[model samples]
Target: TQLLEQSPQFLSIQEGENLTVYCNSSSVFSSLQWYRQEPGEGPVLLVTVVTGGEVKKLKRLTFQFGDARKDSSLHITAAQPGDTGLYLCAGRDTGGFKTIFGAGTRLFVKA
Candidate 1:
């Protein structure tokens, strides 16, 4: 079975701090996606990196895909209060349309 495991289930930091979150799995994924969800809202796609060793950036956020396609990472720089939210990583299985989600990392950024 394909499964994704995420680390550092929670994070709290002051404004301008930097942090990193990891997602790992033993199973290979065809594509991996990262999302950020705010209070009372569904997760919105932050980025999708399909190729191995791929890196994508959005403003202060950076995302990287493992060379083995079984892991991924998210790095946030100069985090602001508005950056506080739930960060999730999901993998899409080629065998089916189903996608497996990680436990999620909840971030709290203080002003």
Candidate 2:
């Protein structure tokens, strides 16, 4: 089984600040996804990267998939208080639908 490790388990920043969180794994994944979960709620899918070296942007957030498909990152620009949540990275192996999830990075954006 592949295990994903997320860095900087917690982050706290003021509104309008920029921050980047990382997710890494030794094993390669066929696809990876990012999600954000607010208190008392399940995580919400943010984006999925299926191709190596692929970069995708959603508004002020940028998602990048490493060339080897073993790592990924998420950068949020000018983060707002509304952005505070637990960020999770999940990856699926090439042979199965089972997804491995990182411990998650808890972000607190203060207004």
Task: Please give the CA lDDT of all the candidate structures.
Answer: 0.94, 0.97
Model 1: weakest 10-residue lDDT segment is 92-101
Strongest candidate by TM-score: 2
Q: Mind giving the per-residue lDDT tens digits that candidate 1 earns over 26-65?
A: 9989999999999899999999989999999999999999
Residues 5-103 of candidate 2 have per-residue lDDT tens digits of 998899999999999999999999999999999999999999999999999999999999999999999999999999999999999998867898999
Poorest 10 consecutive residues by lDDT, candidate 2? 92-101
Number of backbone collisions per candidate: 0, 0
